[model samples]
Target: MIDRPRRLRATPAMRRLVSETRVHPAELVLPVFVREGATEPVPISSMPGVVQHSLDSLRAALVAAAEAGIGGVMLFGVPEHKDAIGSGATDPSSILNVATRVAAEEVGGALVVQTDLCLDEFTDHGHCGVLDPLGRVDNDATLDRYREMAVVQAASGSQLLGLSGMMDGQVAAVREALDDAGFTDTPILGYAAKYASAFYGPFREAVQSSLVGDRRTYQLDPANRREGAREIDLDVAEGADIVMVKPAMSYLDVLADAAASSPVPVWAYQVSGEYAMIEAAAAHGWIDRRRAVLESVLGIRRAGADAVLTYWATELAEWLR
Candidate 1:
């Protein structure tokens, strides 16, 4: 009615100038999985292009990611054995800790090295924490594990620790532990608005997770937007340096809310299911892979995420350049 649309859409240059949010190579973080006993990088069938890297291959990947100018890499470990306590998570010799050290050395300040501070990959039962006598997740016991994990991750040279277990008081516990251990400079990226979603299917396969049940008891329900904000507020008060929303595509509303109010950076995880869907659709010629990828990233940026954790972080950075 105002004849404004035509003026703004006049040309490509005009469109570029008017774009509200733009994606850069530095705004992406890659999620990498390293396994304890792999001879080579093992491919995950559920996630078409992702793999669990062996140590040698992981070093190469870190070099490439740093060369590509990615913001960081998030490390997850797949141990050969699991126990009730997920002892490997806090063990200095664990594959994840080893990988974190390797990444930090390989990148050498060229990129941020982040580690996942959750026990899902180490626990035999595949839950995020130790279980009670009745088999329910014991929140208090998990806090102890998290505290230990923070120290290990910081010692491993991780610039940031990702608290993805969705446990109460996790941020405060980890913060105190890190301070007490004299690793006060390491920051925590709290997964504040994580929700129980089907989008983590491929991720479970990537990590070889043995989860017996859903995470709804700890993860938030998608229907509650207000709860997402509350979680962010609590994490910020507990000394979280950054907050994240998981399964970003379906949870843009929550992401936007966190971005609007967060005093620190707001991040989003483009989980495996989201990546698989786009890759599957593109393989079948249902969508243009380049355009679709750019549009998806743009949508997340428009929702106000400062950075995105995506499987395509390296690839996208290359394409953009």
Candidate 2:
């Protein structure tokens, strides 16, 4: 008798029943941007379905995300003003902090309220850290700012602080700050293996970045797989509650390593460039959009991401339900 492996591939029901991996609504996270003074939602040209939401609009988005049953929303702020030190990042009144307050009030019980704790969005030069007079990023100084930012974000009701700056000692610094400030319950999500990749092009536009140069000095080199594993180990040792591998699809090997070794939850970010590529290709009718999106995320899950942060979170969650 011939072996019939095709039996499992015979029907949708058979495939579903024997699937080794599954993507669920509760494992999705939506990354949201809220502008400081806009009266309405501002569409991002590069990322077709995403928008920079105003305060009032952000509330509705949070509610919608909660209704969709996604795991949470990660908030990024676009401030009205930018400066060298990114003072807005530490200000209690900054758009990010304010949005955190609003999100906590709106869906605090329904979803995890997370915030981006990087300086790039608020910095005039758009580097993830403060620059010294020599025009180079100063790592130790950046940690000081991160410490301050962590306490403020926690105070503003951020349940999870995403440290995406790639600065040395950031996780330890922020964790210490949160503990010192009586926010021991708050958690930190380290962007452990964030690569300095071309994949972030659309994200620059979405946040209205003023970046003058590449982040190669801090972000990991995309070509190095072992280094990615090392960063995950470092962040975990430094006290991260969760660890992330960014620009998910292209870095599945690194993500798989992280998921296998890390003690904490492992997450992956389906970055702006990944989202744009799919959306743009679908627009040209090159591929079936729904199938591509589902497969892309499922591949990431199969590679071992406990959760995925994607612009398609709410829509995908709705489809899953």
Candidate 3:
């Protein structure tokens, strides 16, 4: 008798029953941006449906995200002012910290409240770290700022601090700071293998970045896969509660390797460029939008990511439910 592998491919129910991977609402995280001093939401031209949300609008977004049943929301702040040292990052009254307090109050019980603990959004120079006398990023000095920023973010009620700066020894520094400040229960989400990629173009617009040069000096070279694995190992050793591989689709191999070896949860970020490409293509009627989005995220899940951060988190979660 001939083998009939097509039997499982014969129906939607059969495919669902035998599927090796699944994407769920609980495995999704939405990345949100809240702008300081904005009275209304400002639409990002590059990112079709996303916006720079005002404080009042942020509360509504958090409530909607909680209602959608996604795992959590990661908050990024767009401040009205910028400085050399990114003082806003460490200020208790900074937009990010204030948003954290608001999120904790609004949906703290319903969803995980995470914050982007990076200086790029707050710094006038737009580098992830403080610059040295020569104007190059100073990693050690940056750690000092991270330590101070960690305490403030934790005090502001951030459940998870996302260290996306790619600075050396950042996870350990922030972990020590949080513990020293009596926030021992707070978690660190290390952006372990963030690449300096062209895929971040739309993100620059979303955050209103003032970046003058590329982040190639700190961010990993997209050409090196082994470096990605090494970074994940270092972050894990440095006390990260979770590790992430960014620009998920292009770096699936790195993500899969981390997932295979990491002791902690492995997550992936479907970055702004990835989101924009699909959205733009769909707008042109080049592909079925819903199917593409689902498949893209499902591909990440199949590649061994425990969770995924995507702009479409709430909408995708609704579909998954």
Candidate 4:
């Protein structure tokens, strides 16, 4: 009884004094969706309070993110046009790139502006890469597209490119392309351990994902923990400035493994499904929304994420402040 643990829980001040982990505003990044040709913000049905922003709305969101003191904002584009090759992804005037420019201009000095460097949102078939003649996802060809995308995204003045395509040789390809294009200083935030998860259901709606069957051909299998680490290792070796383990709540082991081994910073994504679950429970009065949100993000940070990407970034930053 001499080493009673309850003693530390005796008061709020005592609990804070012995706290092992803390969440900070600077460690949170907001993921925002910007739609092409929309005059007004569009609400995502599955995700309450989240909106697909128009150009004006996106700028406002960037300003809010800067004011909230969040570390950065990640941009995803919902283009009005889609094609077989995902041509919009590499186009200079593409929605994602244009939005990146706007975000950078609005908050360049205040926060890091990151663009989603993937073709899934821009392609008609909903695949992350182009299809081969036999219909398989062409890994090598996709790396070529990614190489083009890196320069386009870099030209938009983005501080980081969120390489979420999960393609083979993607990091090296993009790094080489950027360096060759004189964008050697732009960092790459590789989605190293992204899993093909059921939890991505809400995300398909968020980006208007064009996926048909699944991203299993490229994304990591959810059951393989060691493979996730291997992906992180490969990415780091190929010059990824930061590595991420996605769907943070379900992949803490992977996140922890990456953080332990990575030479650079490790990040975790508190994905759409994770946010929706908490919101749904809170709406039904099953959980305290604020407390649950704080706990979920804090758990990610404690699991060894140097930073976290979450829909709740702005609100969480406010709460922490």
Candidate 5:
């Protein structure tokens, strides 16, 4: 008789028993945006239900994330002002810092509070780091800003810093700064394999980015798989407790490579554009929203991701439980 694979797929109980990758509430981390001076949450048009939150709204979201049993929340701040050097990023009184303090006060240690230590949202040019006179991203100078920003974020009680700036030597620089400031326990989540991709379109709108040009100068090129591994290696050697691949769906190859080789935990960011694609298609009745969402995340997890960052973290946690 011919072998029949259908035997294993015949029952839900059998399918559940053999499932290789699982998504848990504690493995999901929510990414949230808090805009300065907003009295009410501002809905991002391109992103459908996602909002740029006011302080009050942000507090509410933090509480929701904790209640949903999400392991962490990654915070991004939309400042009312921007400058050449992204000055607000390092300012103690900056909206991002203020929001971090608020999150820490609200959630305490019940959930890990993470902050984006990138200059993109705060910089007028919308680049991830400071630019020099020639208009190119100045890596060394940006590392200095990262160092100061690390101390301030640690002071604001962020348990993990999402280092998304893509600056060379940034991980080591920030780690040194944190240690020198008596923040020995603070951890770094390095966005080691972030790529310069068109998939970040929705994120630009969500953050109200002022970018006039592409970030190809600093971010990893999508075509280079080996380069991604090299970057992950550098981050790990520089003390990144956790390493991540951004725009996760398109970069699963890179994610798997890092996960296979790295000693530390590997993370993947199911970025804004990915969320919008599924939501937009589902809204059009082209796909089953619930099933598609679960399948997408499951695929990523099966590709060797330890945890995933998703905009639907809260809702998925509820569904997963």
Candidate 6:
């Protein structure tokens, strides 16, 4: 057996028989970016095939993803204007809220509509939370905004609220707000182990973020592994229906830890910069694009993620099918 490693890899049929983790279309959730007031789908140069879609285009994209039988679509909004309080985030008429409504209606019961309940894309300061007098993210103050966001998202028909803001107590805050607002059935997907990562560079472009400073004040430092577990524990204790690890590839250790310990489903987000790097390499013919994409996703799956939120979700599912 020690000298016969090729036996399992000898043929496609053999490989299939021994495959421990198979990527399924229903296990992929596409992360989509929708910009307010966009005339057309604006291609993000850094992300090869990704675009900041107009609302109409967003509806179309969701329809396609739903038809492909993907699990869901995670929405990120690029508001036309952002403010100190990220007023647009809680506004029922905000582009993100409207897009939620449109996607929910367009997909009907075919897809699980989810929304990013974060202020980064809607805040002029480009932080996940509202700033305090010291210009630092005020965790408690931010909780209020998240509460409003929960109701708005629920009213707009979001089945899952992606609480990507890494502020303290966010899960409990949003959970209470949603329940208090009579949206008791809406689930909160807590971004429990979000790291302050260089991998978010392409995400800034995807969301057209106007960030001025770093998010190290709130987001976990990349070096701290134990803290990531603590964060996951806190989120789980605070009523998170599911927990997630962001920038999945580099944090597979954290992902594995979370998956091993989490009481609920554990998910991972294959962030934008990770997508861009593979795309860029493939563009220069350094790697086979299709193979690399599936491999990267498979690696995440192999790390124990129950589901993956990926920019390539729809395309990858279609290709696999």
Weakest lDDT window of 10 consecutive positions for candidate 6: 1-10
Residue 32, candidate 1: C-alpha displacement in angstroms = 0.4
TM values, all candidates: 0.98, 0.99, 0.99, 0.99, 0.98, 0.98
Q: Provide backbone clash counts, one per model.
A: 0, 0, 0, 2, 0, 0
How close to the true structure is residue 54 of candidate 6, measured as C-alpha lDDT?
96
Instruction: State each model's CA lDDT, in order.
Output: 0.93, 0.96, 0.95, 0.94, 0.94, 0.93
Q: Per-residue lDDT of 228-281 in model 4, one digit per residue for the tens? A: 999999999999999999989999999999888899999999999999999999
Off by over 4 Å in 1: none
lDDT per residue as tens, model 5, 12-55:
99989877789999999999999999999999988888999999
TM-score, cand. 1 vs. native: 0.98
Runs in model 4 deviating more than 4 A are: none
Tens digits of per-residue lDDT for model 3, 1-321: 599899999999999999999998989999999999999999999999999999999999998899999999999999999999999999999899999999999999999999999999989999999999999999999999999999999999999999999999999999999999899999999999999999999999888898998999999999999999999999999999999999898999999999999999999999999999999999999999999999999999999999999999999988977
Find the candidate with the highest lDDT and give its number: 2
Model 2: residues >4 Å from true position, as ranges?
none
Q: Candidate 5: lDDT over CA atoms?
A: 0.94
Error of 6 at 266 (Å): 0.5
Q: Give the Å error, residue 77, model 6.
A: 0.9
Error of 6 at 199 (Å): 0.5
* Tens-place lDDT digits, model 2, residues 10-84: 999999899999999999999999999999999999999999999999999999999999999999999999999
- The TM-score, computed over Cα atoms with residue i paired to residue i, of candidate 3 is 0.99
Report RMSD for candidate 2.
0.7
**In model 5, what is the error at residue 31, expressed in angstroms?**
0.4
